[model samples]
Target chain A: MKNIDILVDNATCLRGDNLIFDNISFNLSNGEILFIMGPNGCGKTTLIRSLCGIQHLENGCIKINNVNINNPECNFLENLVYIGHNDSLSENLTTYENLEYLNKFDLSNKDEFISNPNKFLKFFDISKYKNYLVSELSQGNKKKVALSRLLFTNKKIWVLDEPLSFLDEDSKNNLIKLFLDHITNGGLIVTSTHIDFSNYFEKSKYLNMKGININE
Target chain B: MNISKIANLKYFYKHTKNVSKILSFITFSLFIVGIFWGLYIAPKDYLQGDSYRIIYVHVPAAWLSLQVYIVMAVTGFIALVWKIKIMEIISIQSASIGAYFTLIALVTGMIWGKPTWGTYWVWDARLTSELILLFLYIGIIVIYSSFTDKRQGAKIAALLAIVGLINIPIIHYSVEWWNTLHQGPTVTKFEKPSAHITMLMPLLYMLLVFNLYFVTVLIKRVRLGIFQREKNTKWMENYLND
Candidate 1:
């Protein structure tokens, strides 16, 4: 696998006349995890969105592998896997169907989940709900279906927001293991959460949005 | 020019504020003149008489209904291709305005048809295609509103708008394509208009009025959309304070 490097330089975001965050900067390479910690409404989601090229920055730019995301020639999205606060799944579609639709965006041959979705669904403990409509599933199960995309997608970078909120303890543990395994294979993950992950990954980097501080 | 520069909501909001006022003034003036000329000053139609004055309203509305859909389709294309937020907002905002124009065209056509054709309704090619156009607009509006994620809704709606564009040419050429109770051509023809100069003049004037009126209303609606979508942005706060 090739190296993955992300650069967020002097980022600033504003809401109305309010300054959400200012002069934030960070860098990450393959196998490193970026944990954005913040209180509610502290611009954690905004920062995550900006990094994923879903939101524009007022002053700075985010680059993946030295190419600025705003550049039209940049094919950043092809290598990106994003799961926002919303699961972004169709409620009317079954769990398996939703995964099938999302997998079409995966350019690489990551068909292990596509061929046998039960592998990832069982890992998340949602295999029984595979044929059920997404609307019938609980919030955690919906989230699990969304998270299962990570296992099937060959994209190197995963940007997630509040991914642990609706998951139970066992699901969360399973997800953390998946995260660890992904980084071990040179994949990079950027996540926003209020929970402390020090107990899970001691080497994980932290960016606290409350004070625009970076703790390496 | 960079598309992002032109599509900037802050600049567009302010620019439309100054421009819409002038457009509104011109629209009001033209409506008054067109009404007087078509209803009173213009010589009566030798064949149909004053009942034909409804043409002043019907023709302009019918022309604008198609024009607005074209605008919606173009904006939808830009939104889908370039993914400009302003274009998405413009595409969705045009739906209701275009729908209203289509409804006006249909109702006024019915009122005109009662005296001319001896019936208020027919499933003629021109009329049927127009009704379909209105349904397309309604479909876009409903599909857009159904999604909780507004961006996703806009994308799906944009795709529908582009696909629905095929109906425009069908609507435009329907009269030529099929035999129908609808009249063939008027001021839109390539040759000289069949009507006399005085009678034709007001119809043209009313067409201009409708065009300007669409822009006037579109500017207002798009400005409102920008405000609603950017309600929490710094530019909006600055704009509100000013």
Candidate 2:
């Protein structure tokens, strides 16, 4: 275990004049799997964004490995992986080129990621579309390519917002299998999704969100 | 005290008060003084007569137009690298201000040239390069505004801004590089200014005033951008209350 931990203390968030959530607290450390479940408009997306350092909370503090999220000296992002609602891939670039762009992030064994990646592409069954521009790819194909990046980076904490959105059943099964192995190897996965994980994986912890003071 | 407040739009407004107030006061006062001094006090050009008075507006626009482009590029770079929301917002707003100033510079230069150069428009290097700068600004605006994803738009715009920076040096050195209708450098250089001191002094003040004006405008634009972006947040609604 690499001792990965996230502490969200008294975390309150507001969306416009609407109070999305308030006084929400949670802690997850080392090899933990947390599935944030909520209906639409329940602030699941907002909470995930705040955890990934993209969205700002109104009156709260988040600490990563005991370092305050606001601390300039914090090394949290270096060890974290975040996939938001937006696909960060460029449409003008081919799927391979988009993947190549992510190679700029400093990571060990990146030399092995050179050129077309055969393993992850084959896993997602999108090996045929590697050379196609992301704009040309179907929505499902584009989503798969974006999801493959999670398997590419070796970060400790993965904060994914709607990781299952647009993935086909077979690809979803493959991903769940990969995530199972990842958690077994001491990685932390925090994701928000409406998909039920009860049939496939029973070991996953569920954190239900119902907005501010609406305990589920 | 919160270092991270500068990143998020909602929190950014909370911290905008002090800096915005001070800059607005300074820039407005200087604008009044600089305009008065340039128009009434400065002596007329011996050769061009009172027509050179247009330099008060033309020169400041020329300087700021180019400088604002550079600032836009800088903000774009920060937005791309650090993923700051304010930087992205500033990059978009700066592009328009830069374009506005470039328009003023071009129009004023043509007015000044009509009496002096025998033609209002020419194929001179400085003028052509400045026209290209206008195109670059338009290119940035079009690329950024057209995209469905604002962040994606910002990323592409930033790259373009950085690439467009190569033109700045060309625009500055075009007079020296080619035999152009535009006059060679009169103010910028290690050598003392060739123009009369009284004339140079007001022009200098106008340059300072123009830069301060850019900042004042930037601060106001940034505040508006922050508000609109955070429209979904309760804090923004409460913020409007006070």
Candidate 3:
């Protein structure tokens, strides 16, 4: 697999008077999953948004595959997929339509992907409700649809903010396995989880937000 | 070069930084000059006399009212095709401003009609279509703000705007198609204008002025909308901090 490098340098994020994180730097390469462990309200989501280039940095920059993300046209978005705290799925759309719409921007193998949105749905155990409107689905199923977006996106950098929060244990384990399989196939994953992922990832690094000063 | 490449180049150049603000300022200034020339410098008509001066305001308002809808429809197309948020913002703001001008035109037309046509209002083709144009604008804005999910709302609104575009041409050509109290074309390719150069120049100037005023106000409204929608975004934070 070719080396894929994601670097965030000297980043500072602020929400109101509270400084979420400052002077933060990190690097993730191919086949590595970096686990960001932080307490509630510690800017983990803010960090994820900044890395995705949806949120701007107060102090620094994020480089994806050696391209500066600030330009917006640097093709960085094509390489990265972000699933934020809110499930960005359209409630009025059926699960099938949601997946199809999300995959519209992707130039990947379309036939292969479309033929088996059911495959991921089955893996996530939401196959029975595959045709259900997203609004009618349970919270966990909605999250499943949001996560399913990642599978169809076929991007290298996956930035998932709290992917396991709304899932049951079995679904959580299934997701972790999916993450592991993604990393095994040479894709990079950066996830923020309050729950411990120590058992799933052998070399996962943790960032504790409790120790960081919020006022600075 | 292929049409697609030429279009892509046009799109790229259109979105090039610093273009919107410059166009906005120039259009705004022209609008101001047009308004002054139309409202004051234009010669009074021999028959209609002083009351004909209302045409300066009425014609421009009517033109921009329709023009703004066309702008919204185009921007709506862009928003849906490219998923560009800025396009949606432009669409929403343009609709609001366009609806406002359409209302102004209709009301002023009624006032002018009352004095000249012997009725303050009539269910005439041009006036009725103009009213419908106002409704379409209102419908677009209502659809945009009704939903909690902004993306979904924007998509629906864009679709609504595209569908509502049928009303624009109808409003423009209504006076010609039907024999009504509303006068026919002052300016059209197929027919010679009834207006003399002395009166027509000011009417044209007012048209220009109204367009500039729309551009200025639309820019301000769009910027405000952008700030509101992107309040939580980091770029918005940077803007606020600055």
Candidate 4:
């Protein structure tokens, strides 16, 4: 297993004039999962964004595999797979085209991605809707299509915000199975969700954003 | 000053010290002086008479139209190369101001042309190139707004700005390269300016005023960009409170 260490230390954040969270810290490694839990306005999404490098922290540092997140040379993004609250899929493009765009344009390891996306679509059980435009897909199917990206990407760290939000119980269980499969293969995951699934994983850690001090 | 520090969005947001006010003051003062000098003090053209006074506004507008694009292209290059968010903001914000300058130049040129070239519009090379530049600015703005994700839009627009830089030299040399109704260079030549000292002085002063105006507007717009992009950060919150 390739060594993957993720550390967030003394992290502080605010949204506009409101304190989101302060002095929060955590660490995780290969084959491990970190579940960030909090109430609706407790900065769970903000922390997830910071972990993905989409949002800046007010203080302290985040390091992945010993490389600081702020460092230009840090290759953390190359090893990351993120699915935010928004699917990040183009609405005008069909499901196939969206995945094709990711393969052709977005991913760093373009050649490594399977040239045919049918396998990923099949894995997500959305193969029948491959040609349907993202705008045409229902919310649950849209979430499934977004989840399909994880199958094709060989990223080590998966950061998902509310991965189970719109899914049925069956799809949720399927996703948890997929997460377990990923972890067993020495992958790291940091996900934020309202539901707690710590009992399903062996090396899972939990951080409740609501428990953190909110600096005024 | 460290280049990285300047590019740092938070550093720029806090340390910029609101210099747009000072720049606006300088721009206002210089504009007043330049307009007075050009309209009243400068000697009338032997050929065109008082009508040539339009050069004061027309020349500066034209020059700044081109100059603003250069600034956009340079900043775009920096943003793309270094992935600096502030530079991206500057590159995107510069498009509207640059477009306005291009429009002003084109409109004023047509007004001046009615008396000088006997028509309000023509297929002249310089004029066509300047019109194309305006289209390029519009293209950047439209492409940027089309994307729902602002960062992605900024990146794509930055690329377009860099590519459109080829039009700059074409516009600069169009008069010399092709037969056109428009007059050739006056203030930009390598040798001493062709126009008399009195005529050249106010034109140069007006050029400075236009440049100062660009900086003032650009600074304000960039600050606004910072606020919008960084609205969720603590420093931004504190800055807003202050």
Instruction: State every prediction's TM-score relative to the real structure.
Output: 0.72, 0.61, 0.55, 0.67
Query: Which parts of model 4 are misplaced by more than 4 Å?
Result: A10-24, A39-61, A69-186, A212-216, B1-29, B79-93, B141-159, B170-194, B216-242
Candidate fnat values, all:
0.00, 0.00, 0.00, 0.00
Q: State which docking tier applies to candidate 3.
A: incorrect
- State which candidate, 1 or 4, has the greater DockQ: 1
Candidate 3 residue lDDT tens string, B27-91: 76776777677667777666667787777778788889888988999999998776566677778
Q: What lDDT does candidate 4 reach at residue A157? A: 92
> How would you encode candidate 2's per-residue C-alpha lDDT over B159-178 as one tens digit per residue?
89988897668655764466
Alpha-carbon RMSD, candidate 4? 6.8
Q: How many backbone collisions does model 2 have?
A: 8
Query: Distance (Å) between predicted and true CA of A63, model 1?
Result: 2.1
Question: Model 2 off-target regions past 4 Å?
Answer: A1-25, A40-192, A199-203, A212-216, B1-44, B70-92, B147-167, B170-194, B208-212, B215-223, B226-242
* Worst-scoring 10-residue span by lDDT in model 4 chain A: A105-114
lDDT (Cα, 0-100) at A32 in candidate 1: 84
RMSD in order of candidates: 5.9, 7.4, 9.6, 6.8
Top candidate by DockQ: 1
Q: Write the per-residue lDDT of candidate 4 for residues B165-231, one digit (tens) a residue.
A: 9766765576446633343443132233368998998998898888889998998889888888778
**For model 2, how does the per-residue alpha-carbon lDDT over A95-138 read when each residue is reduced to its tens digit?**
88887787566353466667448776788898889899999988
- Candidate 3 — which residues are off by over 4 angstroms? A8-25, A39-64, A67-161, A166-187, A207-216, B1-51, B67-97, B115-125, B140-167, B170-193, B201-242
DockQ of 2: 0.09
RMSD of 3: 9.6
Provide the lowest-lDDT 10-residue window in model 3 chain B: B184-193
**DockQ, prediction 4:** 0.09
